[model samples]
Target chain A: MPIACEETGRALTVRVEGEIDHHAARQLMEELSRRLDAALPKSLTLDLGGVAFMDSSGIALVLRAYRRMVALRGSVTLQNVPDQAAKVLKAAGVDRLLPWNE
Target chain B: MKPVNEAKLTFWSRSANEGFARTAAACFAAQLDPTLDEVNDVKTAVSEAVTNCIVHAYPDQLGLIVLRLRLYPDNTLEIVVKDSGVGIPDVDQARTPLWSTGGADRSGMGFTIMESFMDAVKVRSRPGKGTTVTLRRRIARRFPG
Candidate 1:
């Protein structure tokens, strides 16, 4: 997984590319958490336009990111969700828990 | 029903193998000429099954995992994932959505995902004997353009 972070004032945009599975989620989570801690932005947006596939592991990763933002008193949003990832998120009902843009 | 074609793969239970397992299953299913959606569904279901083996079945150490693929004359694909690790004592509770022993990072929706993506999912396990998940889906045959 390749993750890129862009900081624009108080908001941070994270672009995640490639597959999200049990194998990749760990590294993705660690990298995302590290970036989140370093930025500590008031608003976070995860860009998943480049994601090709995701399973239930993506749901957990998103929830963790959401909880971290909640703990930090920040807001988080998911954008550009691909069709494959959307199906998994929807099946797990995680799509309703957070704000996501198709 | 007898399968027209079949194959089996045996590998160690490692998280890194999750992608390999799913991709292998998808590749095996490709012969059916399934649609993109059908292919994704198989990939997702296989990922969940293999993930269970990696995360729960062999939580403590590495173990063997076997994946079996079969093709039916009816354009159906059958996949079997077996792990000889610690088996689930209560399959019912384990099948419940959002029920997970896997820590904070796990959503515990593996079974649900498998059920949703596959036409049928059957799990058979015994304590200390290991677990086997059988998934089947009928691929839609596309008409000639």
Candidate 2:
């Protein structure tokens, strides 16, 4: 997985690419946590446009991000969700827990 | 029904193999000419099953994990993932949605996702023995325009 992170005016955007399974999700969670803690942004936006595939592990990643943001008193949203990833999120009902940037 | 095609793979219960197993299953499933959705569904289900073996079945040490694939004439794909490790004590609780002992990072929705994507999912396990997950799905035959 390739992830790019940038911050603009206290809002951080992390764009992830490639497949996300339990294997990759472990690294992703660690990296995201490190970045979120370092940046302490007012809000976080995850861009998944480049992701080719995802599974239930994606849900854990998102939930971890949400929980981390909550602890940091920040907000989080997901954007550019692909069809395949969207199906998993919808199936797990994570689509209802977090807001998506259309 | 007898399978017209079949394949088996054995690998260690390592996280890296998660991708390998799913990709391998998808590759084998290609012969069925499944749609992109169908292919993704299979890959996702396989990932979940394999992850269970890595995370739950063999939580501590490395162990052997086996994946078996079969295709029937009716266009059905059957995938069997077997692991000989610490088995589930309660299968019902394990299958419940959002029920995971995998700590904070786990959503405990692996079984739910597999069930949603696959046509049928059967889980058989024995404590101190191992666990086997069988998933089956039918691919809709599509003719090119």
Candidate 3:
């Protein structure tokens, strides 16, 4: 996976590309954790527009990030999730907890 | 008739298992006459099952996950995923929706998705032994004149 981050005030927007399966999930989580810990962003937004495939592991990654942000008294949002990935998230009810931008 | 062509592979109990499973399913489906969406459902279900083994089965320990694929002439595919880790203590509770052993981030919907996507799913677990998950899907047959 490819991850790029941009900071706008206290919010950090992370753009992730490539497939988010089990192999990439750990690396993605570790990288995100490192960035989030250092920047201490008040909010984190994940851009999934470039993602082509995602499994339950991807959902786990999102949930992990959300929990981390919540613990830090922040929040996490999902953006541009494709229909396929969105289906998995919706089934997991992740859409209810984390705000999404279409 | 010959039994369904079978292929087997074993991978280390790592996160890569999920990728291996998904890719294998996709590749196998491409050789058959299944729709893209049907293929994707098969891939996703196998990916979830393999991920479960990587995360919950061995935890941090290094182990092996065995995968078997069978393609029947009737357009049915069977996948078996097996791991020899600390088996699930309670299969009944584990299959419950939203009942995850992990933190809040875990939705505990892995089994649910697998069952929903595949035509059949059977899970066998023995607390000190191991766990094996079998998933099968029937390829929609084309009508003949």
Pick by TM-score: 1 or 3, better one: 1
The chain A TM-scores for the candidates, taken one by one, are: 0.95, 0.95, 0.96
lDDT of 3 by residue, B39-69 (tens): 8788889888888888788887978989988
- Chain B TM-score, candidate 2? 0.98
Which portions of model 2 show Cα errors greater than 4 Å? Answer: none
Candidate 2 per-residue lDDT over residues B83-144, each given as its tens digit: 99999999999999999999988899999999999999999999999999999999998973
True contacts kept of 2: 0.79
Calculate the i-RMS of every candidate, to one decimal place: 0.7, 0.6, 2.2
* DockQ class, candidate 1: high
Which parts of model 3 are misplaced by more than 4 Å?
A71-75, B1-3, B102-107, B142-145
**lDDT of candidate 1 vs native?**
0.93
What DockQ does each candidate score versus the true complex, computed on alpha carbons? Answer: 0.86, 0.86, 0.46
The DockQ-based CAPRI class assigned to model 3 is: acceptable
- Could you give the DockQ of candidate 1? 0.86
Number of clashes recorded per candidate: 0, 0, 0
